[model samples]
Target: MPAQALGLPLLPPSKAKGKDFRRGVNMAITGGTAMNFSFYKSLGIENLVWNHGSLDTQIQWFKELLPSICGREQSCKGYVRKSLFMFGAYGGNDYNVQLLERGLTPEQAMNYTPKIVGAIANGVVKLIALGAVHVVVPGIFPTGCLPIFLPLFGDGDADLDDAGCLKAYNLLPPDQVPQLDAPEAGGSPPAEAPQLDEAHVRGLLRPRVPDGPGAPQVWV
Candidate 1:
């Protein structure tokens, strides 16, 4: 639960001396592709469509919910001006589809990354436009280090971290880690790995930043 409470009122768990206080209604939707469609479509899949939730559905949801929270008659009338918006942790669904459904190599799967990133970046911008002040977009996990990846591309000598994660597969560049340089007396290096980081995320999302002196500060 890597959470942040921004300008939100925190209340006691139980009533004290007949004084009752409670927190605001917090809305959280699933972000991945398995049960979510937004991530699935972004990964370049068009034929088989399935989604419990999508970005469009969420935006509409916020539109309806914001007015009630802000004490207004209608939706999104600047009521969400100071509300916290948690957007992502997306792109995993895209990666999953590429690797599992398409049966593509890591390198091949990553080629479709820009499309997914752009889609996520655009979603963040949409939230900003809707008056969401604090937005938090989570990063994806290291797929190569995931349990499913090892068996898919196992070479018997798969280099791993202390937790058995692939050493060759990480967020850092291959050149920076010596494990990717050469094979040791133990396991082999990873053939490929997804690069997930703040810099990379910000770089892709940068282009969508509003061209103004007072543009909102979005952290992904």
Candidate 2:
């Protein structure tokens, strides 16, 4: 399906009261990271992450709103089972913070990929504990292909790939991809989960390229 058909409209801010969530609510925040600020702080990285809407924060918000969204523990379980959860495209900004603010090279930034992916896996486990049956956890996209990265990192022909995307920046390692098939991350999500294939999800999440001359190029 198209990205627009994913679900309901933008949810009100976490502090907003009495908002409708019957359809669904978007908890995603701009500049949100998988790991919290404290995680970076422990590593002596300061003044890097500006927005504090980390994954843990958003999940906490969901826990608080659950009562209003569905009453009673039993009912909440049913509500969650029937609902679709889109976990993330996290780790993008996690790397960005290291690269842009901490002055780490892309390779150096990749050293934290395991931890970043682990954080997202932990999030999926949380949703599963909350009775989430079908959680769609999207992996990070090709950073080099991003328009923002293209201009910022591109230097010369040596840096560009055959497709003109920066070779160094498009470093989404194979192992870093979230594996829902793992037993810990809900173990293949049962038979009832939405049967979204790899190609379909990729198409939905792919950065939009311009169709024709003067056509707008939209990025996800």
Candidate 3:
């Protein structure tokens, strides 16, 4: 039987004496911590695979390349009972792009986060259906710490998304730091806080998911 570590600690085989009891696969995403890699290796796992790059790339790679490799002649050729599958990453880069550059309001961003998360969860289920006996889907990191977020919220005052880079990025506290008094920060309120335009950014961060599965089609 094939075994997958999925970036988890390797466990000893049924038989000891340092003999490998089974074939193993290690799959990890880029930006995934080293601790995950170390944990798998320490358990004496040999085969390793990784997913690194943009979300689209990672998805494509998982759906295509990883499966192809695992099912190749050398990898799983003549085994009587063969199992092939993958472990996918947690988190995505779209929210950061939307918040920092596209200038989506938090409310708009929040609305999309759940959908994106749900899609990922469904992707995991699809992987399982595709002969993936085990799949590991990690969670998204707290995004308030991206370096790009620093200048966005420079004045330490709560900022609203005017659909402008300066506004949306500035809405989030830099480094996820608690909102604290910035000694001399100053910005005039524009007579009133602008109401969030829901429809404007809804399409930006999370494009309307297709009727089924394909590249995320953008309205524009």
Best TM-score among the predictions, by candidate number: 2
User: Over the stretch 164-189, how does candidate 1's per-residue lDDT look in tens digits?
Assistant: 76654443211121212122201223
What are the per-residue Cα lDDT tens digits for candidate 2 across 25-69? 878888899888888888776774446678988898898889988
Tens digit of per-residue lDDT, candidate 3, span 39-101: 334535333432123333444444454433456634533331254333333433435434544
* Clashing residue pairs, backbone N/CA/C < 3 A, model 2: none
Sort by lDDT, best first: what order?
2, 1, 3
Q: If both were scored by TM-score, which would come out higher, candidate 1 or candidate 2?
A: 2
lDDT of 1 at 42: 68
Compare the candidates by lDDT and give the number of the best one.
2
> Could you list the CA RMSD of all candidates, in the order they appear?
11.0, 10.7, 16.7
Q: Count backbone clashes in candidate 3.
A: 1
Candidate 3: lDDT of 77?
30
For model 2 the TM-score comes to: 0.72
Model 3 TM-score is 0.40
